[model samples]
Target: MHAIVLVGGKATRLWPRTRWQPKALVKIGHYSILEIIIRRLRDCGFDRITLCIAHLGDMIKDEFGDGRHLGVAVDYCAEERPLGTAAPLHLVPDWTSPAVVMNGDILTTIDFADLHRQHTTSGNLLTVAFHKSLLHAGVGVLRVRDGRVQQIWEKPNVEWNINAGIYVADPRVRDHIPRSDAADMPGLINALLADGQQVTGYGFSGQWYDIGTPFRYQKAMKEFLTHPDRYLRPDAPSNGNGRRNEVALEPDGDRLSVADLSPWS
Candidate 1:
């Protein structure tokens, strides 16, 4: 499967930690967040990958120039301006296959190949992966009727099936995005709905973490050291020396632009 990993967020929520490097380049263990994600994708049978990058994109392009080092072919699409989440899809030249698009900061063990397989069979234009999460209301919430308070619940734990920031989209989905403005996946989903295209939600449980906040980042770091096996496959490709095999990039100079480089051939 050809996968597009969105790595271009400003990540203002991550602040100084991402001040110098894009969140995808932030290192949690022996590898950067993007590196581990790509490695996991490779393990799940994805061989062609493209990164949609912006903030500190040049560094990302330099670090994984051709993706050969990771046992897959890699290409890059740089967003000259922030394109939200889905707009960057327009920047890519073309990836004809049904593809899974993911947020750069997410670390998950979902089998992307399987996700694509399901998308093909569902007859849906879009299939989104969702994970359940509980959030505290923090303050008492009340039900009101005619200036009278119905029962009050204090700090309820709300259960929700949150978007995992991962999706399998048909190539034609891009046709819905206009080249003029920034668009996000949510907007794209809504557009698909308005156009009468079918969309689906795939819910599953797994070791998934969105390293968007410092607390979450710290938690991932701790959990990974304690249970690396949960996230990484023992059979995943690796160099005998105990690290991943990687390729060196050509000497860097000027910054890159949208669709400037590809490894499709």
Candidate 2:
């Protein structure tokens, strides 16, 4: 399967860090966000990857070059002007079916293959990945409508689901995106909903984080450090024997064997 990542956002929320590098290049623990996504997608049997880039497009191309080093071939669709999330997918020429699309700012362990399979077999125009969130408690005082005193309510938490900004979209859906620079994903979804297209939501109950803001970017790194096993791809080596610096890569042949090298150490 082929995958396209929307890496074009300027990431103004992450100013200084993003001033020097694109959000996709922003570090989360040991690897950049783009690298993590690309590696995970490759592990899930996706070999062809295309990055949609606008701001600092060259930096992304220079950093990952051909995707060869990451065990996946890379291609790029540079948006001359910032084309909103779903619009850029229209730039790819030979996309025959629904393709995996994801935001470059996320750090996740979602199985892309599963998400894609759900979209294809279900015959939906689009598939969205969402996560159920647990809300935190808050303290508040309430007044009664009658003369009787109203009860005080303590902080309470709630649960809800939110869009994770990853999608598997049918190529036919591209027609819904407008030809404007400011067009975004929300507008596309609203159009699909109004048009009565079959858009299904796929729930992912696993590790996922959007490193869009400074707080989230930092928090993600700390979280990964604490629970490295949950975030890093299983194909990547573990720090099981107190060795937290090396990863085994078969750059040549495709077999599950390890050859140790001190490249990063």
The lDDT for every candidate, in the order shown, is: 0.77, 0.75
CA-only RMSD, every prediction? 14.3, 14.1
Superposition error at 168 for model 2 (Å): 0.6
Candidate 1: residue 37 Cα off by (Å): 0.5
User: Where is the poorest 10-residue window by lDDT in model 1?
Assistant: 239-248
Q: In every candidate, how many clashes are there?
A: 1, 1
Candidate 2 to truth, TM: 0.80
Question: Please, what are the lDDT tens digits per residue for candidate 1 over residues 1-265?
Answer: 7899999988888888899989999987887889888888888788989999999999999999999988999998989998899999987767787888999888766666666777788888788887644455677655566676654556655545668899988888888887899999999999998999878777555567889999999888876776666557735322221111122223133222112222221
TM-score of 1: 0.80
> What residue runs in model 1 are displaced by over 4 Å at the alpha carbon?
134-158, 234-265
Cα deviation of 249 in candidate 1 (Å)?
50
Q: What is the lDDT of residue 22 in candidate 1?
A: 91
